[model samples]
Target: MNKPNKAPNNKEFPLTRETWRYIKRRQKELDDAFLSKAKWLPNDNARLSALLIERGELINEFPETFKWWKHKADDRARIIDEYIDLLHFLAGMDGMPAALFTMDGGYSRIMFEAETDKWRRLSNDYVLEQLLDYSPNREYPVQSACKVVALATHIMGRLGFTDGDILVAYDAKNAENFKRIAEGY
Candidate 1:
């Protein structure tokens, strides 16, 4: 698989080609191990549903993002962890192309200039729209997958997360997932 090109124009979103490669390799390892134990692969519809569910879980970490009246401190660490959890499934989905990790110039810009809550809501809605477009019957599932990845990366960037943060969190979560599989989880 071709590695992603240079990092995007935004320095804060420093997902270098090496980082992308590591993520792909690690996720593949996790998927292979999981499949070996489970002995059953999910269909495209099932994968899509899992992605949607994970997205919901990630959103749930930031209640203040949607709840206008609920003012609470943002649990930044939990939010990032949830986002990485979503990535675990997204990266492992069947036929997730290497190009999904490639970030274009357009994605480097924030989708919304509004305040945190408004921008987060808008970005989440946009990502949901892309996720809803994915279907097993689609002529080009890769295209839909690409849209989701780009939107997902954009969300991370908007949240002010660095590529380093993703790598660290992914490693932690990945290790935990492996531990779970070993324990027959």
Candidate 2:
């Protein structure tokens, strides 16, 4: 139940340990890839802008009866149509699991059992008390709570908790490794 009016304050959502660790891991991977690449492509920002503009126009002209138009109609017409137009391409939408937070529609499948339980156990009063305690600075608590929810979900899912529904499936070799470690004397 986040306030829909404003984006949460960044200070209130300062990165948690798991979130920071994930960011570091991603940075290391990016550095490794950059060092390994034998060739680099020149920046294509201008071409991308032109393409975006062209697609934006086409998307606006799409039949108003199009399926996606209904969901996005409340937003600025041009921006919503422009984004949906971009989603029309495979390269634009594929292979991006991490950038899903740009819009609510992008969440793949949110299994909220764990999230709901966490919130229930933590209690709204406790959260509000924390917000009040920090209120001298007027910091909102919603952002940090959201980040905690996300990181808890990721860490629990990664560790094979959360009913295994959100967990990534493992291959046979990894399954055997799990058994060996779990059964250690």
TM-score each candidate.
0.68, 0.19
34 Cα displacement, candidate 1 (Å): 0.6
lDDT of 2: 0.30
Each model's lDDT:
0.59, 0.30
lDDT of 2 by residue, 1-185 (tens): 11122222222222223323332343334334443542543122322333345343533432332335454442233432332223222112222333333222222122233333443455333433332232111131222223333333332332223221211111222234335445651
lDDT of 1 by residue, 1-185 (tens): 34343344442234444665577678888998998877677654556567667666666666565555777966889877877876666566535442333322212222222122233446555644444453433444333433455555556776677777777787899899999998999
Instruction: Point out where model 1 deviates above 4 Å.
Output: 1-14, 94-142
Task: Supply the TM-score for candidate 2.
Answer: 0.19
How far does residue 105 in candidate 2 sit from its true spot (Å)?
A: 32
What TM-score number comes out for model 1?
0.68
